[model samples]
Target: MSMVNQTQVHETRLSDAVNRIAPSGIRRFFDLATSMDNVISLGVGEPDYTTPWNVREASIHSLERGLTAYTANAGLIELRRAISTYLTKRFAIDYNPDNEVVVTVGASEGIDLAIRAIVNPGDEVLIVEPCFVSYAPIVSLTGGVPVPVPTEISNDFMVEPEEIVKRITPKTKAIMLSYPNNPTGAVMSRKKMAEVADLVIEHDLTVISDEIYAELSYDDEHVSVPTFPGMWERTILISGFSKSFAMTGWRIGYLCAPEPYASAMLKIHQYAMMCASTMAQYAALEALENGQEMMDEMITSYRQRRNYFVKSLREAGLSCHTPGGAFYAFPSIKETGLTSEEFAEAFLMEERVAVVPGHVFGVGGEGHVRCSYAASMSQLEEVVERLKRFNAARIGR
Candidate 1:
């Protein structure tokens, strides 16, 4: 006789926070775009160039030397020292390599750790609207409230100190800052950064500054908010090799902060993941040392592409503010009477060109779209022609 089983069973249960998070809206469109034929994709934020030869050679050398074992929790000491030196040389930000820096898997991990380190459940994290898509979901996953403050094309998408000051309440714990910003490509000025630093000091709030695109500034110099007096102690500065060195797949990033907070973040780093890849760390050291020439060349190309793409979009009857930094151009397409998603879809379907809907970035982005100019000049030229044809048809209809 078959007897009924009497054993107790257990099943996997995902955290409610995980359930609440949506897959990246930026990525969702790319996945759909790839299945189509003859698609000219400007949807991705990746650099179209291959990783520089020197950086690739360094990684290869590390692998040949069998430097594949797990690294120390804070990452390779040499890589940390390289990071500290690079930031100091480039941004004039001071950080001690031994105690104050932790190499993360990527800036993405740095964001997670910063939010998790300081936020207690129910605390609020302030974000700027038309922001990178990850910040809100990551805050929510850390059990913190995500408070978005809208910036505008009129102000060039730069946040005002007063807007940040007003967003604070007793529950507000920290602010997430990204400059040479993704999607919008807006940059923070030194004076504005100082104002933000002043506000943070007045309220005694922490800052998670993501400067991954720091090296991509086209027309302006990038500033670190932490350089302002008293802010070094209150800010966790995040940057990585991905954007500057065209090393996205390598996934090497670092965080710099003062004292107990740094220690707290390192604890999370140690437990969750021991370190970033060993070879990648070695390769990042080379990237920090020998990659500046490559970066300067790439930046020069990106600037030309930026100028060309913005002109092309305007010629196509779209209004886009020329971005000050990063590789994306966020253009307003509301005149087409299409929602951002519908506009992106129709653009792709009709012109065989892929650009992301700006709403995917956040709420204030409804009438806009983001296209990366990181592609080759030839591709950019071709995309512009397709857009012009698409616009002609759109206007006729």
Candidate 2:
């Protein structure tokens, strides 16, 4: 075949949805950092701590006992019940584990199930930005329109209800929220969240709330969306042991919703992924039961790192808002007169310091770079020194 004809055939073989979305901006830098020597990465988002020993031992015990068979499609009842109890105690919300929770491969898959269950083709999903890189692409893959409602750093990246109101339309089916958000590490105030809840109730829309970082809230106790009045029926809560328990590789996450939504998502979960790993589920159960002290220690360390990192970024001449949750510091690179991508690439190549370009995170992200403080304190200290040198060179030029 002619080269032109071969190219056309290759293009035609892929789905339109696959072609429409871009690859993850985070992964591109991650791959680059991995290939290079001595790169100090502030790019990836997982916790620096290993899964606690007790949690690992629980999984080892499960495997030793040959408890390797799949649990129910909804996951081990004990884990679900534990999740239910934890939610009640932590967020003052109640969920019936029997019919309302479905464990998935990760919070990533829980997000996929929620969007797939609720969004019909051509329906609009309001996504607050800058968010985790996956949300918009996942919505698009489902043939749903992802409407970006950009939140400003000036507001600490909190999504104002008016921004959401401006984007709503007759076809809007849902809104996606992640507080203690990714990239920016912005957490919403309860008063602000209540305002958003009011909007959701007014519009009669469903909410896909990703609360994976709920336990890592630094300044105040994290608030679950479903805890708000009138929100229980409308919110799908997604969380897991990945961040808090340092079990990213274990792939145990879950979603909770009203029976109708829960059942619909469970049906999808059954067909797409029968169940999360049995051993992982066992480990997660151990985490809920006995991992609190270790998790609390990790949170304390993260809080200290966050304070030091943000302070260093400011002193290095970058304007950074104090992130209320998560471990990222999104600092403006606007003063350097470089786009986020340019700054990130140059910083990586010259200083061996890796950060994600903010524009990849969607609207209102172009002038900043996302730096994760989830690394060791020593690495973070060195990163600040490299950043200072980089900034000085830029000024000199």
Candidate 3:
């Protein structure tokens, strides 16, 4: 009779997939770095540069003109048109502005929308290991199972076509590819891309290609996977100004996909976010139209830093590859006799320098750590000295 007269109670029903998803290891290290004073962070994957002055001016202009209302679910006509021209001019891909593009809150939201639009319960989505953290989680949340294909350091982390072919099953619905990749900074060559395109066509699987760091390609020119034959109908090209233009806070990104897919994605976006920020959209349009000069300058700087950091890693006795694109340097920390997490923690505590543990990226990432060189030259020099000191002690032992 204990509480027998009470009203009925109900238990919460959370999806099993939601409960099973792992948190980003990269973010955990970043949080740890923030709590420690005097720490030099190379953990977060963000550009440290200021937003271009011209982009800022555009936003201010929009505000002064009293353009504050919700424009359209698809986005402002002017911005979409600007994106159309920019993509064609830069990547040689064609998309109709009226039906093929949808502005997003960020490439992050674009990813979520893409997953939601295509995935049904229990469908399979192929992903490359040491990929961006959000891809797998977004797939799970959409009730799509993530099938990870591990890339090798010996191969420079480029996905092998045979590996992709081997991983595909009848349930596979889509594949996600990111080049000028985070963590590894590996880029797919044209021949490699052609192989992937052939596979995606053969498998009849959709593709979500994250090319956010497209403009940061150091060794080779960046190309859109969608530009390859047969990929146009099956690919969603995701990019933004955040990494390229140092406009991370602006939070405006866009996706270009074939229609019906684009329309469905826009529906999800309409309900979930309504639209990207009106002010940010204006700034992003300005970025597309006038930010190329700014990009040339930043890319030149990143290339210089990339060269310096790669040499520093080798001189410090760490095993590393020459990254072709992006601002990160992923190097093996195994020789130091510490697990990735142990190496990260000990380095932070003793040297006051923080880097993301590679295991956070996936099984293939063990024994490695990602160091972002997006910081200033002075900061890079300081971190290099700290790493050298750490390596000297390890060698002495």
Candidate 4:
């Protein structure tokens, strides 16, 4: 009788969408590095700097005042107002704080909300390749096809309009863009961005533009997609304080779009997230108001690091394009005759340095590996020494 139990055995069911995507390749290497001792990691893209003291104090003050309750579904009105003001001041874009902005948990959440709001099942979303790894998987989770439009290092990694045009189809719904782009550190020139903008207008497609690294642009003024003619109506702009303000743990990001789209994203935000943290909102408000000097100092440091690191990589016998923005150095490892994953693993094991395999970033990311320059200069100097040794060994082998 004990052996003839009536309960039927059933395997746990998970969403096919969840099953479809692979675990993040960035986190895999980061975790492997964490498990080791005295490892100088260039794997994760996080800023090594801590959040500014004034911003932290603002959050602490909010807690002292007993402001721990949940905010409105759209987030604190004051924070929204600050965000609207900051955008207008910094990027010359306008959004009505009341109805056009929704504060999200992070720029990461803003991406998720924007995709889920607009992407219908079976729709196709064009993703710029060698991008932040989250984009394609998020599109796939919504049952939308993630079509990668690859950019090349030889072309300075700028997206070519003709390539995008080739990928266009009736099922295509929107295009996802990130300039001061992750992994590649490519920033789209305004002239080039305008060309892409023209295509979006001609096709009547929406643009989900993630400008989280907007303030980190080193070569030229960062362009906001919404600033282009006809783009304001169609672009859902996403940005945050993570990279620029060293506020990654605060998780404060926002979405700005037209009323209809904002409302839709708000609906999803209300149900799924309710609201972003109240304390973080206060902290974000302070950052927008008074964190400019500290942010500028961080940017200056990153620029210096970028110059030294890229030069160092090339001198060490790897072909690295000088990044126009962001803190990553994407160098071709193809000369070693090893895949990106193999190189990253072997580099980590032998040299005690950690860099992410570029193939994880989607098409066109292969034959390269992404090394972050966000670590200390001393660490970077050591990384270059080890890289030189590694390259020499590979060449000799």
**Candidate 2's residue-wise lDDT over 36-126, tens digit each?**
9999988998998999899999999999999999899999999999999998888899999999988999999999999999999999999
Candidate 3: minimum summed lDDT over ten consecutive residues — where?
4-13
The TM-score that candidate 1 achieves is 0.95
Across residues 121-233, which tens digit of lDDT does each residue of candidate 1 receive? 89999998788889999889888899997888888899988889888999999888899888899998888888888888999899999989999998877888788899988
TM-score of each: 0.95, 0.98, 0.95, 0.97
Displacement of the residue 199 alpha carbon in candidate 3, Å? 1.2
TM-score winner: 2
Worst 10 residues of 2 by lDDT: 388-397
TM-score of 3: 0.95
Tens-place lDDT per residue, model 3, 1-397, is: 3454332221125556756788788888899989989999999988988888989999999999998999899999899999999989888999999999999998999899999999998999999888888888899898889899999889899999999989899999999999988889998889988998999998899999999999999888997898998889999989988999899999999999999899999999998888899999999988988888988999999999999988988888898998889899999988999999999999999999999989888748889999999999999999988889998989652
State the local distance difference test value for candidate 2: 0.94
Runs of candidate 3 exceeding 4 Å displacement: 1-13
Question: Cα RMSD to native, each candidate?
Answer: 3.8, 1.3, 3.4, 3.0
Ranking by TM-score: 2, 4, 3, 1
Better of 3 and 4 by TM-score: 4
